[model samples]
Target: MTETPSTMQMVSFAAWRDGALHSGRQADRRYVTLAELLVRLGSFGLGLSWKARLFDRQPHPAFAQMVKASAGSGIPTLELLATDAPYRQAVDGDFEGYAGSELALTLREFDSSCWEVRTADAWVLSEIQRHYPDARPMTSDEWDTTT
Candidate 1:
């Protein structure tokens, strides 16, 4: 088995729907962070009968509030994240999961059109890149400016 890194660094990328890079809103694209993706994988098993197959943790307090409000108001989670101030604040706060001694992996939505997956695990990053041939790495400057 491959050894996991002691400290993981975030990798940012964009997956274009067209399988090619485009400029200036010309094509449908999803901005993804490696950590968010991992959390999503964990979340998929939340209501299942089997034990969660991926890392799982209680959501941040603010995030839990947004979830409660979204359920009561019948607003979609994505819509809540996009339009609700409290949801945005919760997202801005620490909301990622960490494994062992690795750094926290944050899950955030930059455009609010989608929730990007983020990961600090190199193995996960490599697997995602292999599976997603259309995904391209985002430079630190690009990631910083957008986030």
Candidate 2:
């Protein structure tokens, strides 16, 4: 297995349709690696059966693939969204899960060249920056902003 990259940009878009947690309608960024990213991602499945499957002290299989896929790209990353905040916080100080297990599973199950591939096989950060070049690094104070 490849050593997880030390750090990668984490881009979090908000989930407006998801309700309350989605109220903080700002995308954000932070640096993280496979370990933390898994916890952060797994948190999304919190209270669900998949929660255990989402996080592992070691990277989960799905997450490992994501790490490997991103590692070969220009910017190693595990892109997620703001709807993930509560899950991340619920993990008891473990910044493990991010809110994209569905995306991860889709990528893992489908052909990379398939039209359905959501990420279009591009570096996630590239995709984010391509669409929202104005996104800046997030500050703790701005974390709760609903804009």
Candidate 3:
């Protein structure tokens, strides 16, 4: 299996779907291999179940914010690492699950030609096909957003 791309090596995998280029850091990056990615993705289901337990999910802004707050508190959220891991456990420990898991995979495969396309055959083809059926695929030049 290949080594997980370092955080600095990541670039957004730009593709068209739903009507726009769905570009952003793919939610999962630290996992080193396809199996690892899938293994972590498996937990994605379990993680989704936790939201029901949170009713006062207010002071925390968005879902990401609630995730950060939970991770910061004592529980675990998205299993994000710390560049250092002194502050994570259980949930892999990310500050927050970013975009979608498929997006994360796409971002890591940004160098692949298949991923740089308007076609539905992306690194995250299923997600692209599902969420961005009408998005206009893009190039790095076209996807230069500050966010």
Using TM-score, give the best candidate's number.
1
What's the lDDT for residue 9 in model 2?
A: 33
Order candidates by lDDT, high to low: 1, 3, 2
Candidate number that wins on lDDT, 1 or 3? 1
In order of appearance, the predictions have TM-scores of 0.37, 0.21, 0.26
Q: Model 3 compared with the native: what TM-score?
A: 0.26
Q: What's the residue-level lDDT of 22 in candidate 1?
A: 62
Q: Residue-wise lDDT of candidate 1 within 1-147, one digit each (tens)?
A: 122343434453343234355676565554443233433444431221110111114545545554455332233323433433332322222233333333234444444333333455556556556655544555445545645
How much does candidate 2 score in TM-score?
A: 0.21
lDDT of each: 0.39, 0.28, 0.29
Provide the lDDT at 88 for model 1: 30
Give each model's clash number: 10, 10, 15
RMSD of each: 10.7, 15.4, 14.8
Question: Per-residue alpha-carbon lDDT of model 2 for 62-107, expressed as tens digits?
Answer: 4444334333221212243222332222211112222333222111
Ranking by TM-score: 1, 3, 2
